[model samples]
Each structure stands twice: as structure tokens, then as C-alpha cells.
Target: MKTLKGIKTHPLVQRLQWVFNPVKYMETNVQEDRDIFKTTVTGKGGLIFVNSPEGIQELLTHDTKEFSAPGSVNGILRPLLGDQSVILLDGDRHKRQRKLLMPPFHGERMRNYGELIQKITRSAAAKWKPGQAFIARNTMQEITLAVILQAVFGIYEGSRYDELKQLITSLLAVTDSPVSSSLLFFTALQKDWGAWSPWGRFLRIRQKVDKLLFAEIEERRQNWDENRTDILSLMMAARDEDGQPMTDEELRDELLTLLFAGHETTATAMAWALYWVYREPKVYEKLIQELETLPENADPMTIFRLPYLTAVCNEALRIYPVGMLTFPRVVKEPTEFMGYQLEAGGVLVGCIYLLHHREDLYPEPKQFKPERFLERKFSPYEFCPFGAGVRQCIGMALAQFEMKLALAQILRDYDLTLLEKTPVKPARRGVTLSPVGGIKMMMNGKRTPSKSVAVPATV
Candidate 1:
């Protein structure tokens, strides 16, 4: 019989706060309505933000039936990912697209990328000399981008690869700040006034990226090879249930989606992991001891499965989840959730940030404690950094794999120091949350393999 509570602030002010300081906005609103609250953050029509584990489970578990995960609700990303991107597709089409794209990111296929990830991480880390300062996020971006380019597209070095990498970095840099990121949130500010304008620069850079993507798709189409195992090749060969291949447009959009989603989120995560590990000497020493247990030239999978290392990565993700909210799930029929009645067509998003910070789920949630993960196992809904359900991140496996392996490679090979004593707060980075100032650090020199005996694995 009760209706969802709505934030009393003006719609425009709420939207601005959501864009400018989303963490503050969510924390402020959650204080009023802990379980579920309605806000005009995405502009009017009442978007519900749910953080309670039971509420989230109810929303995501029944996403396919009781609630609909419509792509139209994700229109905000269309400009960057295109309408054909899987993130912007709903229903049967979305399901089909996911099926086709799922192969390369999971199973034994992921094992193949391990060596490549470590190699890329080492190569990037090699560039940092002792006492050299670098931004953790930028370095991680370089590593992730290279890993994706070669692992997903089979491009390591070439004019096309270089141009594509530079252009994509340039494109992302435009929205690096909240003020610049506003162009994506507010349609009114998305005006293209020329190359001098923010939106205009974004459009021009996007055009270049599209040109490169289309070119790559076209070249691959002309020189089709059945033996190619890269994601692009797999996508080109994949046929839908109707036996029709994806169109050039679809391929281009999906490629951009992978390139953006794959590198951007993973890089932010690795940077945060680096920050947490180095910032806490206890975490850093514990992780190093675990990493030293592996034999020289250890199998990437062995490194991947290290217990304390896994805990560190999990804790990092839990603390400041890269993606704040899951893609919106709309109510398909009248439903009652956590004693509140919701009408058909109600919009809902699982607020991952507040959920992870819940006092009940994670005691002392603000502290960076990797031991918590090792202490207790949480249900998917309770510890979902990668938003659960049908729309859960397709690259979830790869992101974690890359995060663990890359962190292992970096930590095991190099000693680094966190340059900032002050905490770096999470700030809006496009649609995801990233560490402000990107976590500055200085390389201390390469670490030699420890002669100490391997410690017993404890999970």
C-alpha cells in the first residue's frame, strides 16, 4: 500500500548533483530512504535507487520476467556506443548479441590471455624508472588498452593500431573531468559548436575512432581467415540463430563497446587496487608474501588463483566499485518490493555503491580490509561490484583476470610507493567511478624473486 519515497529536491538540482558529485548525492539521499528511494537524477519520471540486498535480489533475479531490462533506458550511452551496441539492445536481440559475444571472455579462452596480460603489464611497468612518478590509472590504462587491442583484435603494433589507441585515449580524455563529463548527462550541453567546443571535440574524435573501427572491420571482412581467434574474428564468424552474420554497423558498434568497456573499467579497477595495496603497508606486505610463494615463471593461472591476492582484488572492487549503478531495470507489472508497492513502468537501478557500503553487509565498510573477503562469503547480490543479473558485465571474468594477473605481475616485479598521504576520493569518470587525481606513485625499483619457502595456500 505504500509508495516509493521521492527526494524533495528540485529535479534539475538533483540531476546536477548526480552529475557533479554522485557520491555525495547518493549518500545524502540514502540517509533519507535506506532501502529504496526515488530521485530525478536522470531527469524526471522517478528513477528508483535500491541498495538493500533483498531489494537488489528481487530486482535482478526477476529482471527477465517481473522487470524488463530495456535498452532504450540506456539511451545515454548510445552516442558513445551506438544504437547497435549490445548495451543499448533489449529483449531477444540483446540475448542473441550476448550469446555471440560471450565466448571469448570466459572459460579456457581466458587462460590464453594470461601470458599476454602479464607481458603487457611488465612492458608498461618497465617504462617506470626508480623514483619516477606516474599516475597509476594512466599506466593501467595503457596496459589494459594494449591487452585488449592484441587479445581482442590481434593488433599489437601497426599504424592502424597506434592511431586507434591515440584517438581512443584522446576521446576518453575529453570527459576525464566532471565538468567535461556533463556533456554526456545533459542533452542541452551536447551542442556541437565547432572543433573549439567540448561536444564538438568529442564528435570529431568519435568520427576518427569510427573511421578506424570501420576500416578495421572492412579489412577483416575482405581477408577473412577461419583460423583467427581474436574477438573481432570470432564476432565476424559468429552467426545468429537465423544464420545471418552481424552487419558492419553492428560489428563496429560492438567493437567500440568492447574497447571502451573492456579497458576503461578494468584500468580504473587496477589503479584502485594499486592504491589500496600500496596505501596499506599491511596489505602490501601480505600480498607480496603471497606473490613470493609462486615459483619463478609461475603459471598465470597459479598467480590468478592466489588466495590473498584474490582477496585484495575483491576488497578493492567492493570498496569503490567502478560502475556505480547497474543498467536500469523497468517494472513490467505492478509489484510489491520490500513493503513498497511499485506500479508498472517504474524504473529501478541497483545502487551498487550504497549496497557495498552497507553497515550490515560490511562492518567498517570505509576501511580497506581485504581480510573481510577471506572471512565470509557473500551472496552475489550482497557483494556484486559487477552488477548482477542478465545484464551483468560480460567482461566480468576478463576484468578480474586482468586485474589479478596485472597486479601480480606489477607487485611481484616492482616496488612502488604511494606518493599521496591523503585519501583519493572517487570521482565520476564518464559513467564509472574512478579515483580522483588517479593515485600518484613512485617506482622504488624492481623486486627480486624471494628465496623464502612457499607459504601454504589459505582461502
Candidate 2:
């Protein structure tokens, strides 16, 4: 059997490239080897990066049997999401934690957040004037963070809520650059030089967040509210197979996971969707035509089912996926992948970036084309921005719902424009790729619905 193709560069160099300039690194490597490549940049040991849809499907579909999705492979995230976090657990523990957390993000519980999401968007959008310029990502971050706080802890408009929001935003901003992202990838650089130091600042902010989280957990434990449908309340009330409730640390870890993962990535996505919609005049006009088709009094779910809007969101995700790779899946037994021999513990990651950009899967992959999604359907594996299988993001449904509603609300009610004609480039924002300079834009004015559509009651 032939060995996997890879960059024959030094491991340290590859690691730095992977952490510092991951987009460039991935693009360069993909040009050299189209389908798969063996690399040593992700965490430790050897890792094979799979790009083809068939290969990605093969890996994700049989992940539980021939391969295993272990949380230990996600150690790079441990400093941010603690060991007990669901994202870092494996096997039965992972399954159980997911079950405990699943109820709040799916079904009726998730639907309740729709109105709140639209209200939060409108509330945030109200502050802007016709001439005022704003960073789309930062604004979106505020909306998403507020939405998560309300959905997760059922807290809004309080000192604790305000403080947590400020601290979390500050904490995430600390690692918004490529150089700063290295702090997470290289654990050795995580030093406590002082409170002002990069690592030191992260730790200080984290300590404050932890104190608040622990206090929240303790208070919730002492006074459990069965009536509340927020995620934290649901998690607090859940019992495992042993009929045991989660500990304070477990609750805190999971809360941080939900807070960080839920808001941060979605904010980036919303910003990108807005940027793309405004950037392309044809797209902007088409979206407006579709939005005007719905009555102004339409429910959030009705707005969500819009075809062209869904395609726009999907196209944005396809262009720059939030997560570059699936959580690394390990070989559970000896198996061959595309003629390459595998050991029981070999590591592999489906390169979501490469897969989404493949010309075969998406014609003219570099172009921003929403029509492709509307014209033809793509399989789950072919268009998985949230990953798939056992490791599929539990928040997928909520995130998509929030995106569609928030975008619909903003697009239908507000007129915004990119501040500059230059293109916005995607750069590393912590673990996810975000628009550089937060995709600066100016709010032109509020959009009035067509005369045919009755004005809806304001939330």
C-alpha cells in the first residue's frame, strides 16, 4: 500500500504554520495533495487529513465502530472547556452528557428562544443611526451572547448578566488574532507573566468567569426551578443512569462550553452572512424580494423556511466553515482508508475547509454562489458545516434557527452596507475563522416592509 501524501517539513514548523496561518497552510497543502495528507500539526502524533466527500463520509459514518470520537483528542480545548465538558468526554460519558444537555437545544425548548432572538436583534439594532458605522461581528456578538445568556441561564438585564457578558466578550477578544491563537495550540506558551500578559490576562478573565459560573451553579442547586426551561435549569434537574446529578464543576464546564461554543461561532456566521448579502447587490436584491413575499406578521418559523435565505446562510458556511476540522477521530481497530494501512490508534480529521471548497462538490468553489444550494441538493457529508455523526454539534438546530431568524429580522427591517468596497478576508479568531476587522459596515436606515405586507406587532 502507498503511504499518505504530506508536507515533508519539520514538525515544529508545521505546528507553527497550523496554528499561526492555518488557512495558508491548508491551502498550500491541498494544492500539493488533493485528497489526503499525513501531517503532525494537530496536537500530537501523526494525523491524516481527509478532504474527499467519500473519504469524509467513510470516516464520519462508521465513526463509532472502526473509529472512536474520543474527547482526549480535543485536549487543545481543555484550558477553555474543562475536562468534564461534554466536548471533551468519550464513550458512555459523552453519550450521557449529550442526552442530559440535548433537551434544551432541541424541540419546543429551542423554539421558545425564537422571539427572544428577534427581540435581541431588534434591541441591539435600535442603537444604530443611519450614518453610524459598526463592526458587524462585534454587534452580532452582542446579540448572540445575549441570546445565549437568556437561553442557557434564563438571565437578562441584570448586573450578573451584564458582567458575564462583558467578561466573556473580553476573554474571547484576547485570542482574536493568528499570533494570539498560538496560546491555545502551544500549552507551553501559557505562562503567567503577569495579569497584563496574554496568558495571564486569559487566566484572570477565566477566574472571574469561573467564580460567576460557580456561584450561578451553587445558587441554582440550592433552589432548583422545575418551571424554568433554560438549559442550565434543565441540566441541573437531569439525572444519570446512577440517578446522580452533575457536580458544580461539571455544570460550570458545560455552561462555559455552551456559552463559548454557542455564541462565539454563531456570531461570526451571522456577521459573514450579513457581509455576503450586502456585498453582492444581486444577492441583496434577491433576498429582499423573498423577504417581501412574507407578510410582516409572519412567525419566526415561517421566516426561517424561506428558500433563498437558507441558501445564503448555507453558502456562507460553505465558503468559510466555522470549525476547520471535525473533532479528531481515532481508529478503534485496524482498517484501511483509501489504500493506506491504519493501526488501532491512528488519528484522522475530515478537513471541512477543503471538503467544502472542492470543485467537484461545489463548482467554482471560490465563488460565493447561493443558487447552487437552491438548484441542487447536497448530501449531509458533502455539505456538513457543523460536522456529523456521533460528534455532530448538539447546538446545530438552535444555531441554524437563530441565524435564519436573526438574519431575516435584520435584513427585513434594517438597511446596512459594507463600509468599504474592499473584500473582507477570513482570519483566525480563536479556534474559528472570522472576518478580519470584524467586517466593518454602516447602518444606512431601517427598511419599510412592502405595502402589501401588513406591519407586524413589535416585540
Candidate 3:
């Protein structure tokens, strides 16, 4: 494992925000160079960096139970989710919540949602016009948002879908800007002039989304729908060992967590994947070729099998993961890592960005190459875009499926090129990390590669 026995800092560095120059100061620095170096965040904020594959493994695995995700990994989300949110819970409560939610995202029931994902992707892809500049991030956001709605509500439509979409758009607009991430480091500043402040204005919008969610929960409760299988319906029907249903408050928190998380971060990742494929045409070509080999209207598992596309998406996430750090876990007993003794409750950031860009494991780490994934597969800790340990993203499978289907659908119909020669790096998108300036690109429509049939975006 790589290590720097000491940490260095300058006075000017202390005043900086982690969100402002995230890749510049942390993940990028670690990516373009060595692993296991102690670095200063703002001059005062110090973290022990583990950029090497092996070091990353130790941080995420091995003694994982010791290093808890602490501080502001979910700071911006706290106001919305409250302390009862699964993201805030640890140990037993976390286990129970995770268990309760797990069933909905699994089994053949989950597979049933793939057709909906494909339909949504097709609808969105059909909107692209040749010669027009399309903002990849925005497009993917719409696609994933629609998919999540259907996945969560078992087919949302009419006033509710439009209302929900509008509310979510408003809520995300505040968080999507680079400013929200900066709030993590400076709570007082945010309370004053920060974009997350009331002046930036997201509360009214969130309440609207929440109102719809709770109202739906209430309606469902008044008329229990046994036919429904989406999370909200399942949660409504769920009873603990005591044969008691979950309260509205518990239901609300879980719904809010899934509703907010379901679409936002996945949208960011899909956007980045599109940008990388366009920015690096060869990678896009490879993805297209691989996607072509899939059977007509392939199943989700088959989508997962498109090795090149899978590698490209995975690597895109590794390079520009939406969430910068993993969920916090605290040490219950004394432990040692990086040759330093750690006490219980000691904080550790999962630092996925730094780990993915490790120079030693990923030579010329910044280059967009998906083959590295095929060349050698790193352990979960080494390239954990969705994080590792038991707390790894519950929606990882869902997110990956969406990316593959969406990308495959888009590439099948249109060919695109970068509108700007120089690319923007990932900056904080609200509570997530995404392309800084929005991935601006122009479309180049191509008919089916194998056959001459026209491909329409809508199902």
C-alpha cells in the first residue's frame, strides 16, 4: 500500500470548500499521482488519503466496521430526510430499514421494471434533433426521473406525474448547481449567503414533492392496493414481526430517501457516461459496436452482458462518480489503518474518486479507457463508484440497468459529438458530483447500424 508518513498544508488552503475544487484538490490529485498521502482540504481540514488499490481495499473492506461514514456525507440531505432517514441510521436500525427495502429492489418483481426502463429511454432518445446541441445531463435527468417514477409508483401519469416532475426539477435545480457541495464544509456560510440558503429557494418545491408522496401514501392506505409492487406500496403493506404496519412518518422518510435518491444520482452518472463516450469517440464507437451485438429488445441481464458498454459506464462512474464519498460508519472499538491507531467514532470518508483514479492500478489514470475494466477487474474497494461494505448503494443494480438501457437506446438512434473541445470535470451537483458545466454536445443521427430501419425514441 502507498503511504506518506506526514501531511503538509498552506494557510490559503484552509479557507477553501471541499465542493469548490473537489477534483482539483482531492480525487484529481490522488488520481494523477500516488496513493495513501495525507492531504489538507481547506488548510484546517485534514484527511488521510488512500489512493492505491490495496489501500482503498483496506479502507472499504477489511476493517470497514471500524471506520464509519461521518460528518457531511449526507449533510445537505439531513434537512430533507431528518435523523430517522436510513442514510442517518447505523447498526440495527439501518439493518432493519435496509432489509425492509431490499425486497422491492430484488427478485423477478424488480426485473419486471426493465421494460418500463426501456420505454422511458426510447421516449427520451426520440427527442434529439440532428445539428442541435443537446445538454446530455439534462436529457439523462429526464429519462432517469421518468423511469424512477414508474419504478416507484407503478406507473405515474396525468397531473401527478407532471406535478411530481416539476417539483423535483425545482428541488434539483438548487442542488444541481456547484454551490450545494460547498455547503458541506461551511455550515455557517450556508446559513448566511450559501446557495443552499433560503435565498436559493428549494423548500417550497420539496414540500410539493413530499406532499404528493404523502398524499399518495394516504390514498394507498385508504385503499390498500395488493396488486401494486413498487416500494411505496410494498412499504405500506409491510408489517414487522409484531404484525404492525409502519407508521406514516417511517413511510415518509423511506419514500423521500428512495424518491430523491432513485433518479438524481443515476441521472448524473448516465450524463457523464454520455459525455465521456462523446469526448472520446473511440470509446463511443466501441460501446455502439458492443451494444449492437445484443439481441433485439434485449432483457436487462443481456444489457448487463454488453461488456464494452458495461466497462465504459463503470469507468465513467469511477472517474466521475456522482456521490464523492461513501455513507459514514463509525468504529466501535480501537482499530488501526494506515499505520495509525483509530478510536471508536473516528470518521472516515470512503473517497471513491481517489480510489478509482489510482495511478498505479490505472495507468494514465485520467484517460477515458474502458478496457482497463476488462484487462483487470479491481476488487470492490479499489473501484467502488457505488461504495463498498454492507452499506453499498442499495440501488446499484437499478442504476446500472438504467444506464445500460438508456445508453444503448440513445446510441442506437443518434450519433453525437462534443460541442466543446475542452471538457468540464465533475463538480458537486447538489448532493452529488456531476459534469461541471453540463455536457454540451451536438447530435448526429444514424439509422440502424446493422439494418436500415428507422429507430424512434418513444416506445
Candidate 4:
């Protein structure tokens, strides 16, 4: 067995780069070792970052056997999402939690939220007047946040709902930038000095959010309505093989997990879609042309099925996957990977950002070309924006649904312009990458409904 190679940079410097400028960090390191490399940025023992599709496939496909998706490896997120989140569970426990939570985000149950998604988007758009400048990410966040809240709680309006919305937003904002995101990376920085300190401020807001979550959980427990379809209610009623319900602590953690994962990532993807669409006139015109063919008052599923719209969303997610890295998968036993020997307890992660940008897989990888998707179908291992295998994002179906429907409604009804001439770059936002400056834009005017027409072959 040969020793695995890694970045030559000092551990401290690599860790700093990982926290402060992860894109640069990964790009520079991958240039040194394209397929696989080790780095201590994640922790003391170091983690193996795998960029090859085969390696990622092997790592994810045998996750339950050759590799174990241990919750302890995801300790970096425990502070924000709590310990009991499906994101933080392993083995049978993880499978059971996913079983209970999966229903609300998939199948017909997910489709039920389509009308509500469009309604939220339209309501959000109504607030913007012609010539109004807005941060696309912030605007989209409001829309996605509302949709997730309603789906989770089954209520869109109320004092607790409004307060939870505000508190959760505030809680996440504390880590909106790389500097602030550092608190999550370095345990030493997590000290709560006071309300004025970054970590302190995060703790205070999180406390408030927790109080509200527990209150909602406790209130629902008292009522225990079997008819309620909201995620929280469903979770409360869910019984394990042992016939036990999720505890309040478990409920609180999972709720935070759903909000953070379901809301922020989808909003960033939508914002980027808007950026790419408006930035390229051909793409925008072509998308509108495709959307125009839909009959008046088209249902959400029809809008979702539009090929160009699906490609556009696919390209956006591919260009800058909201989650840069999948949760870490630890080796269950000594195994060979990509020509190198690996030992048990070794940590490995699928570098989603790097994989998506591979020039071999995507020609002119940096260029946003929805046609790539339209021209050919890529294997799941090659084109995964959501991580693959057992730990794949549970909200994958709903996020895609929300993206297509929201983009269709917004583009169909409103004419918006990108404000910046220069291309925007992705920056670290907590654990994920988001558009720098949130992709500023301005509303031009609303477009009148166009009659159904023949679809064009090209833009």
C-alpha cells in the first residue's frame, strides 16, 4: 500500500483557507492531486477529499457496508442543527428517522405544496414595484422560507410563525459570511462572550428559536392530531419499530435541520438561476419562450415538466451546488480507493463543487450552459448536485419542484434585470457557497400573459 498524497501547505494555513476561502482552497489543492488528497482542515487527523466520479460512487454506494456515514463526523454542524438531526444520525437510527421525515418531502405529498409555493412566490413578487432594486438571494429567501415554514408547521400565519421566521433568519445571518462562518469551523471560536460577540449573538438567537420550537412541539403533542399533514405533526405521530415517538429534543433538532437544509440551499440555487437567466439574454429569451407555450393558468406539474426550465435549474445547481461537500463517510475497514490504500476510521468526503466543475465532465465548466443538460443525459454519479447514496438530501424532490415552479412564476410574470455587469462569484455562506452580494437585480415591469404558441427548436 502506498501512502496517500496531500496538500503541502501548513495545517494552520490550510485550515484558515478552508474556512475563509474554501473554493480557492479546494481548487489549489485539487491542482496538486486531482483525484484524491488529504487535508487537516476539517480536523486534526485530516480528511480525504475525493473528486473522481468512480471514487465518489464507490464511497457512496457502499456507504452502509464498506463506508459508514457516521453522525459524529458531522460534528461541525451539530451546534446549528443539534445532535439528533437525521443529518447527525447513523445506521438503523438514521434510516428510521429518514423513513419518518421522507414522506412529507416526496411523492404526491410533496406535489401538494406546489400551489402554495407559487402563491408564496407571487405574493413575494407583488411587493416589488417596477424599478425596485432588490437582492435576489434575500428576496428568494423570503419566498423559500415561507414555503418551508408552511410545509413544516402547516400554518402560514400566526404570532409564533412570524416570530420563528424572524428568529431563524437572524440565527442564520450570524454566519452569512466566511469570517462569521469561522465560528462554526473552529471550536475555540465558539465561546459565548456576550450578546455582542459573534458566537454569543448566535447563541442568544438560537436560544430564542429553540424556545419557540419546543413550545410548538409541546403544543402539538398535547393536541396530537392524526389528520395534520405538517412535518412537525407527522413527526410527532411517527412511531418507530419499538412504537416510540420522537422526543422534544429530537423534534427540535430535526425541525432546525429541515429549515436550514430545505430553506437556505434552495434559495441560493434560485438566486443563481435568476442571475444566470438574466445575465444571458439568449437563455432568458429562450426560457421565456418555453414558458410562454404553457396554457394560461397552467398547473404546477406542467410548469415543472418544461424541458428548458428543468435544464436551466439543473445547470444552475451544477454550476454552484449549494452544498459544497457531502457529509463525510468513514471507512468501515481498510480498503483500497483510487489506487491508494485507506485504513479504518479514515474520513472521506465527496467534493461536490469540484466534481461539478471538472472540465473533463463539463466542457467550459465555468460557463452556464443549460444546453449541456438538454444535449445529453449524465449519470447520477457524474451530475449529482444533491449528494448520492443513503445520505442523499431528503428534500431533493421538493427543492427541485420549488426551484422550477418559483422560477417559472417569477420569469413568466415579471421582467427583471441584472444590476451588475461583472460576473458574480460564489462565496462561503456558513457551510455552503452563496452568490457574492447576493446577485443584485431590479424589477423592470410585469409581463402580460402571452398566448400559447409553438415551441422553438433553438433560442
> Which candidate would rank higher by TM-score, 1 or 2?
1
Best candidate according to lDDT: 1
Candidate 2 C-alpha error for residue 289, in Å: 1.1
Q: What are the Cα lDDT values of the candidates?
A: 0.88, 0.85, 0.70, 0.87
Candidate 1 backbone collisions, by pair: none
Q: Over the stretch 1-459, how does candidate 4's per-residue lDDT look in tens digits?
A: 688966677889889899888899999889877888899886567889999898899888987678889898888888899989999898888999988877777777876788999999999988888877888999899998998789776656899989988888889886789988888888998898999988888889999999988888778778777887777787787888888888899888988898889899999999999999888778887898898888879989989899999999999999999998887999889888888888888899999999999989999999989999999999878888989888999989989999999999998887677887788999999889999999888887877756542221211
Worst window of 10 by summed lDDT in candidate 4: 450-459
Off by over 4 Å in 3: 1-15, 27-33, 37-47, 62-65, 68-76, 183-185, 189-200, 451-459
Ranking, TM-score, top scorer first: 1, 4, 2, 3
Residue range 101-148, candidate 2, lDDT tens digits: 887877777678888899999998888888778889888988989888
lDDT of 1 by residue, 1-459 (tens): 897778999999999899889999999999988888999887768799999999999889887678999999988888889989999998899999998888888888888889989899989889998877889999999999998788887777899999988898888875688888888888888889999888888899999988887888888889888887788888889898899888989988898888878889999999999998887777877888888778889998898889899999999999999999988999999988888899998899999999999999999999999999889999999999888888999989999999999999988787677887688999998888999999889887877767552221111
Question: Which pairs of residues collide in model 4?
Answer: none
Question: What ranking of all candidate models by lDDT puts the best one first?
Answer: 1, 4, 2, 3
TM-score of 3: 0.87
Per-model TM values vs. the true structure: 0.96, 0.95, 0.87, 0.96
After the best TM-score superposition of candidate 2, give how far the Cα of residue 283 lies from its true spot, in angstroms: 1.1
Better model by TM-score: candidate 2 vs candidate 3: 2
Can you write out model 3's per-residue Cα lDDT over 100-156, one digit (the tens) per residue?
Answer: 777777767667777888888878877888878888888898888887777876547
